[model samples]
Target: MNENQQSMPPETPQTAAAPEAAAAVSVVALPWYRRPLFWGILLFLGLLLLAGWLFWKEWQQAEATKASVAAQTEQWREHNAALESFMQQLRALLAKDPCEVKQGLGRITSPAGVMWPPLASGADRSDAVPQKPGDLADKSGSGRSDTPPAPAQNNADAQKQIPPVPVQKQTPRNVSELMEQATVLVLAMKEEGLAMGTGFFVAPGYVVTNAHVVGDATEAVVVNKAMGRPFAATVRLVAHDNGQDFALLGVDGTSGIVPLKLAQSVSRTERVSAWGFPGAVTNDDPKFAALLKGDEAAAPEVVYTEGVVSVILERNPPLIVHTATVSQGNSGGPLINEKGDVVGINTFIKLDDASYRQSSLAIVCSSLAAFLRGAGVSITMAQASESAGGKQ
Candidate 1:
């Protein structure tokens, strides 16, 4: 065994180092960038960074979306709140009894005028003649009277002898007079609120106003200065076409008031007057609210604005543009000539935001007549009359 061990020879440092050096050479041969194991670790780190960036971008987008949604929700909430408040107020107004409201109003009295003699209470005595006792007996005996019964006075002779008892005129002589008799205050109770507009007597018991004024309401209140009372009215007709915008109201106890006559044609540059209860005139007035609530003693007077026809639009339903100073409550009011005849119905006003200019518009009489005829309403039109100052 000693001899075998001697022949094998003891292990040298170089031989041991030889295996280690071979392993070092293998490690040096493959660089970090070329080694699969090294690259695997680097790829893992790169993927982790990319994932982190994507997550951050998604989180940022979510935050922005959340902010936008919040803003929209707030706006809707405010809008709904305002709508609810309006509905509540409207309900409160509708709860009150209309009759009680009218009773609360101040009394309107008739105008001062000369009193007439009371009529005799009995049957017709106009034909019966007073005779002396002797004359009646003479007539029964001889069928003839000694005085030869005073010759009967004819109607014309009697009328002359009476010196023509003063009588009130039925027809209005001018626009000022027509306003007192024909123009009316229209109060329409709608879902929105109390819509106030101007109307006039187109017939004995019929009033003409704007369809927008009436809205969907089936009834309205008509106030006449001469009548001195509020009359309940029913919607007779409403023009379906938005362009027409006409509505008719029928009121009872409106008889004896002379209806306004409508003109057949109108020309540009003609003088015209608009009659209505414009809100601009009374909106700020304290008494106006009281008047509407029936607390004021007297009704508001009609306003008249004078202007000339600016232009006539040849639309389907012809439009008359005028320079008349009309406002919100002037809708449905009459546009009249100097002779107190209606030529158009004031509808709306065009406003220019940049220039602050206004153009008042009306539906010509021809359109009104056509609407009335379509509804089978009888409207008395004026005969061919002279223009304001010159011939037509």
Candidate 2:
């Protein structure tokens, strides 16, 4: 009993203390929920889960936006297609019956007497006109007013010293003479090349021609019959009346040109002359073709032919039918009566048969007068016509 007591001499409370301490150490070494490393791992896992959820949400929104844009694009394409189809239908309807007037053929006959309308002033048959700058000098002061002298010229010596007013006689004697001076060959150039037609001077620095003659051309050139020098011209304005074509051109450098006067009256079955450079004459004659091709120095002269008024076709726009021969290049030539006055514009010809027996047609003076008045151009002659308000 003494030897057992010596071996357990220090075992009062220490034996239980050492076992409790060991148990406490072992529990601390094992991982717990409150430990720093364990908490770090848990936080990392939570962050990963949160990132995955956000990525899924963004992908869903992107898919929705892409689908919306695709739907709108499809709708616009369908709308454009529908509009294009509608336009094609409208164009097809306008293709038929394009012209306003449907002209007709009349019986061909040769009348004896020319039908002429009376003048607006029957007693005023005189052809007196204002003097031009280049007219022959006249010493008579008949044109000026014979008023009493002013204060400065009250003396008899002042009256004798006053010079007489000189008159100018620049008017041409006949239409044949006017053609040599004022007729011009109009040439229009475009992407397709050169197009040829005829024109005549109506006023100083102004020429009248057909609109079809200057087709698709912004500008044109006029070649004189004498010098053949090309004068630059601008297409100022164009007017078409129920298929009656007219164009007003503003020309440059018309110093000595004597323009033809417009006739206030036109008579049916009257003797008239058509003057132009006809393509029929040019295509057939080698000399004229050479002149056009610039192979010859001599310019082509104006071609004149006489004929009687055949028939007056009254339609939406009235036309004059004459036996005067004309062709393609004579589109804008002048139709002058025997009184040296412009009565009409040579425009078109109707083909009668397969041989193309064509009838010469012209826009009458009445239609021309109305057009010029509407265009605000002042004419020296009166715009008097029996058929003034007849048609377009």
User: Using lDDT as the measure, which candidate wins?
Assistant: 1
lDDT of 1 at 78: 73
Could you tell me the TM-score of candidate 1? Answer: 0.55
lDDT of each: 0.69, 0.62
True-structure RMSD, every candidate: 26.7, 21.0
Judged by whole-model lDDT over C-alpha atoms, candidate 1 comes out at: 0.69
The list of candidate 2 runs beyond 4 A from truth reads: 1-173, 283-297, 354-356, 382-392
Model 2, range 1-392, lDDT digits (tens) per residue?
68888787565787768988987777645559768998899999999999999999999999999999999899878766765654343333222221221111111111222111100111221122112100111112232323433453344355357632221224556657668667877766533335567898887777888876775566776665543345557788777647668888776557457777787766677788898878767446554444333332335677888887887778546778899888767888888777657888987766554454667888876777677777776655634552232222
Candidate 1 residue-pair clash tally: 0
TM-score of each: 0.55, 0.52
lDDT of 1 at 254: 68
- Give the C-alpha miss distance for residue 370 in model 1, angstroms: 1.0
